[model samples]
Target: EADIYQTPRYLVIGTGKKITLECSQTMGHDKMYWYQQDPGMELHLIHYSYGVNSTEKGDLSSESTVSRIRTEHFPLTLESARPSHTSQYLCASSEGGAGEKLFFGSGTQLSVL
Candidate 1:
C-alpha cells in the first residue's frame, strides 16, 4: 500500500466555508508535494516541502496554504471556500535523490456551490 494518505476523499461545501485537507506519509520521505488538478486538465504544483519545517509555494498561484511540522505530515488549508476552488487535490511524497518515483495519495475532490 502507498504510504501517503489524504482525508475526506470527497468534499462538498458552500462558499465561504473554511476547509483543511489532511495529508500524511509513513515512508519517511523528505520531499512532499501538493498538486491541484481539474477535470481533463494537467496537474499543477501548488505547494511543496523539502523536509520538516521547510515549505515553499509552487508555480501555481493558489489561495491555499500548507504547513509541515513533522516529517510525516503535510496538510493544506483553504481559508475560504469558493466555486473557483473546486478541484482535485493530490498529495505526493518522494525521496530526494534522482530517479525516485513519487507516491501519490488517492486525492480529494472538492466541490463548492
Candidate 2:
C-alpha cells in the first residue's frame, strides 16, 4: 500500500467561496479516485482517472472538478462552494486491477457556511 496524504485535513469557508482539496500519493498509481461522503453515509465516487491527462466524472454528479496533472497528485476544486458542498472528500489510488487494494489519504472535511 502506498502512503497517500490530503492537505489541511479540515477546511471551512463561506458560501460562494472557492476551495481546493489536495491529495498526493507517494507511490505511482495509474488509477485514482475521489469520493465524497457525509457523516454515516455511503461514499459516492465523484471523480476518477485512469492515468495522467485522463479524468472522468464518477457516478455521482458533483459541483466540483478534479485534475490529474501529475502522476502523484490529484486535486479537487470547487469554483463556487455552497452549503450543500459540505462533506468529507476522500482520495484513493490503486494499482489498476479488479480486486486490487486501494491506498487512501486522510480525508478533507469541508464545511461551507
Candidate 3:
C-alpha cells in the first residue's frame, strides 16, 4: 500500500482566498505528481516533480502551483481561489522508471464559494 497522506481532506473557502493543499509520503519515492479531477470524471495531471527541487507543470492547465523541497513532501498552492477551481486534488508518488505504478493519497476536495 502507498503511505501517502493529504491534509484537510475537505475544504470550503471564499473566492479569492489563498489556500495550500498538503501532500506527503513515507515511501521514499523520488517522483511525485498532482492531478485534478471532478467528481466522477477523469483525472488530469496538473503538476509534477521528478525529485527534490525539480518541479514541472503537467499537461493540464491549472491556476495552482507546487513546490518540492523534500523527497517526502509535495504541496499545491492556489494563489487566488475561485469557484471554478473547486475540484478534487490528488497526490501521487511512484518509484522512478518507465511503467512504474503510481501510489495515490486519499485526496483533498476543495470548494470555493
Candidate 4:
C-alpha cells in the first residue's frame, strides 16, 4: 500500500509569518500534487510535479511555491502568510499513468491569525 505523510498537522501562526507545509510519500510515485480546500468547499489544485526537478503551478493561482528535488519529497512554502492563506493543504501522489490511484496525506490545517 502507498503511504503519504504531512508534518505539523495543525499550525497556527501570526500574519506575515513564513511557513512550509511538508509532504512526503513512501510509494515512489512519479506524480505528486498539492491541493487547497476550505472547511466546506471544492478542492483547488495549487501545484504539481511529474518528477524530480519538474514542478508546475496548478489551475488555481497561488502565492506559494513547490520544489521537487527528490522523488519522495514535495514541500510547499509560503513566504509571508496571511489570513487569506488559511486553508487545509492536501498532498497527493500517484503513478505516471492515466487514472492512477492517488495516495493522499492526512493534510496540514494551517491557520493565520
Candidate 5:
C-alpha cells in the first residue's frame, strides 16, 4: 500500500476561480511529486520536491503551481483555473530509484467552466 492522500476526487469550477488540490503523505518520504494525467493519458511530471525545504516547477505547466505547504501537505495551487486546467492531478512520494514505484491515490478530476 502507498502512503499518500488527495481530496475532492472530482471537482467542477468556473473559469478564473482559484482552487487548491490537496496532497499529503504519512510515510515520511523526503521526495514528493505531482503528476497530471487524464483518462488514457500519460503521467507527466508537473512538480516535485527533493526535500522539505526545496521546491521546483516541472518541465510542463499548463497552469499549476505547488507549494511545500508543509512537510506532509504538498498542495497544488492554481491562482486562476480554466477549463484547460481541467484534468487529473496526482500526488506521489518515493524514497529513491529502482525500488521507487509510484503509489497513487484516486486523482482529482477537475472540470473548469
Candidate 6:
C-alpha cells in the first residue's frame, strides 16, 4: 500500500452531484499536493501547500477546490460535479524543497453521466 490514500477508486454518478475525493498521508509531510491525470499522462498540478494552515491553488484550470486542515489530510470537493469533471484525481506529498520526489496514491477515477 502507498503512503497516501484516495477513496472511491472508481465512481460513476449522474450530473449535478456533489463529490469529494479524499486524500490522506501518514508520513507527516508538510507539503501535500493534488493532481489530475488523463488515463496516462503527465501530472497536472491542481493544488498544493507549504505547511499547516498553508494552502494554495496550483497552476491549472480546475473547477475543483481543496482544503488543508491537517498536515496529513487534504480533501478535494466539487460542489457540483459535471461530466467535464470526469477524470482521475491523484494525491501526493513530499518532505520539502524543490525537486523532491512525490509519493502518489492510486487515484480516484470519477465519471459523471
The C-alpha lDDT values of all candidates are 0.94, 0.91, 0.93, 0.93, 0.82, 0.87
Candidate 5 ranges with C-alpha deviation above 4 Å: 97-99
Candidate 2 ranges with C-alpha deviation above 4 Å:
none
Regions of model 4 farther than 4 Å from truth: none
Q: Which is better, 2 or 6, measured by lDDT? A: 2
Q: Candidate 6 residues 19-99, lDDT tens each?
A: 889999998888998989886678789989878788888888888888888899999999998999888888999998437
Record all residue pairs in model 3 with backbone atoms less than 3 Å apart, i.e. clashing: none
In the range 24-62, model 3's lDDT, one tens digit per residue, is: 999999999999989788999999999999999989999
Which runs of model 3 end up more than 4 angstroms from their true locations?
none
Best by lDDT: 1
- What's the distance in Å from true for residue 101, model 4? 0.9
- Enumerate clash totals for all models, in the order shown: 0, 0, 0, 0, 0, 0
Tens digit of per-residue lDDT, candidate 2, span 1-113: 55999987999999998899999998989899999989889989999999999999999999889999999999999999999999999999998842689888889999999
* TM-score, candidate number 1: 0.95
| TM-score: model 2 vs. ground truth | 0.95
Residue pairs with clashing backbones, model 6: none
lDDT of 1 by residue, 32-99 (tens): 99999998999899999999999999889999999999999999999999999999999999997325
Each model's RMSD to truth, in Å? 1.4, 1.4, 1.4, 1.2, 1.9, 1.6
Model 5, position 32, has a per-residue lDDT of: 85
lDDT of 3 at 3: 99
Q: List the residue pairs that clash in candidate 5.
A: none
